[model samples]
Target: MAEGEEVKNKQVLFRNYIDGFPKESDMYISTGNTIRLKLPQGSNGVLVKNLVLSCDPFMLFLMRKSDDSGLFGCYTPDSPITGYGVAKILDSGNPKFQKGDLVWGMPGITACAGFYVVSTPKKGETVFVSAASGGVGQLVGQLAKYFPEGIDIYFENVGGKMLNAAILNMRNHGRFSAFDYLVHYSQFYDILLPFIREGKIVYIEDVTEGLEKTPAALVGLFSGRNIGKQMIVVSRE
Candidate 1:
């Protein structure tokens, strides 16, 4: 790919707002799109080549024409949709990133993305979440390993057995929490801050703060407006 080369940018476009369960017919994949491979003049954006596109359930919520789609907002009637994706930067106008940087984007917490895409966690299931002094959420950094067969992110911490187990027991949208191997003596409650920051776990699950925002927050539980356990705080005191 040369500089400023244009490539076919295939996309999925939602038909319209919905009232119930979204079906395949509600969205259409249009392969007739074209995108330039370079940044616009004076633009400071990075152009990425999406190596893997995750099909998540929150997209269904965004498909609805709603006033409260939380922080992510709603998808346009005829525009392309967005979700968690692993991609390589093809061009960069930002100083922090150079060409060929692999990135996993944000508002990307593990449990919420899981519950939406994979449904509820069950009893007798072996699930592990790592706590690096607690309060960790988001795809803050790219996991050290990338499985080319489409297991988008990974970091080896436990050992080869844990590593092999992860690779073998994979599913679409499966997420692994990061382990801070060095923190051996910290208390459990240290997780509150970052959780409060990015929104996850008990500190945040579909969390909507304040009284004026209560109604929309309530509606979000089943409306795809809320990400995790929906809670509205009228007052902290």
Candidate 2:
């Protein structure tokens, strides 16, 4: 940044709730730059200049009006949207922040917004973030490494190919467990399923989108446990 450069504003708009897979038509873009540079005096809020933004599948859940209240219910029609964004303070009302300080949080848009008004807190140590390469993932990962204990992760980061190799090498009768949010169905079938059978791997499946494809992908992994079938929809509205 240079001295005396004019600041610009951007707004992201919702294109309407989408069905099945999302496409470019599912979102709209709005242009604007006159964001308030400060919060009103006596108000406990901070005005931020946003930095990085993230796009994640969880965002899809927020788009539907019929979604559960756990989703973003306060979002109104026609308002410029918000989400997770890293920002620098343009002004603040709390002692935790000052002008030009960098901060990160759950932006109004959940992890994709341009600016957010929220309390600034100092997050503590040794955080393990999933999808460390992604926008939000990367931020948390970097923040972890910044701490005193500092990102003492068992595994730093792994790509698809490397992860596949690791699973394939597991000993027979080995068990592997992962969170439901880890990967999408298309990816699991194409990558993890084969390794499960080849490594005689025992695991569980909780992801839903791959339900229809489960039988086939499982058949390919014949050695894994075939019973105790549970298809729990952990949080589907």
Q: Which has the greatest TM-score?
A: 1
> Candidate 2's residue-wise lDDT over 1-237, tens digit each?
333244555555565664554444544545555555557769788776655443333444555566473445534445554555456777788888887887754311211111111111124323232333333333432342344333322122323443343343433433332322222334434454475569854543323222223223222222222232222121121
Q: How much lDDT does candidate 2 score? A: 0.41
Residue 69 local lDDT, model 2:
31
What TM-score would candidate 2 get against the native? 0.42
Question: TM-score, each model?
Answer: 0.46, 0.42
Q: What is the lDDT of residue 151 in candidate 1?
A: 41
Q: Give stretches of model 1 more than 4 Å off.
A: 106-237
Give the alpha carbon lDDT tens digit for every residue of 1-237 in model 1. Answer: 678988777666766777875655566667687999999988888888765444444655687888988556898877766666567888888999999788754333443444323333555343433221222232223222323243433333223344554556455665554432222122222343466567664433445554334334433433445444454433222
Q: Which ten residues in a row are the worst by lDDT in model 1? A: 131-140
- Candidate lDDT scores, in order, read 0.52, 0.41
Give RMSD to native, each candidate. 19.0, 19.1
